[model samples]
Target: MTKNVMVLVDEQHRLDSVTAAVEACGVRVQRVMRGMRTIVGAVSDDAAIERVQQMDGVASVREEKSFAVPPNHRDIPQ
Candidate 1:
């Protein structure tokens, strides 16, 4: 199953290289935070996650857990 994940890389590594590595694993990058050396995206499957984890510049790969909020709770008071 595909899952959203956060990919953390070494701060000193080049962002482009890191992105390339993740993309090569068949993962889609949703957002990139260069300062934090982090990339958020989805991996096609468990094997893709493993591949991403083994990448040279990757520090860690963590799945993103989402929590649902009620629609009423999301409204702000005027």
Candidate 2:
């Protein structure tokens, strides 16, 4: 079964490497949240989490579940 995961990366250089690794495993990046840091939303199996964390600059990675969307933003259909 496919699972959702959140990968947190603090280093900019690691972004590409991490993305490549996940993509190689057939994982898809669903969304990317950038704040004081970067949070990546991906869909894959548990192995993807391990692969992401092993990347050169990944700060952390964890399995995440779907929660209520933050209310601060709304859809602006064009």
Cα lDDT tens digits, model 1, 8-56, are 9887678899898898898899999888888999987888888988888
**Pairs clashing within candidate 2:** none
lDDT of 1: 0.86
Q: What is the number of backbone collisions in each predicted candidate, taken in the order shown?
A: 0, 0
Model 1 Cα shift for residue 19 (angstroms): 0.6
Q: Give the range where candidate 1 is weakest over 10 consecutive residues by summed lDDT.
A: 69-78
Backbone-clash count (model 2)? 0
For candidate 1, the per-residue lDDT at 67 reads 80
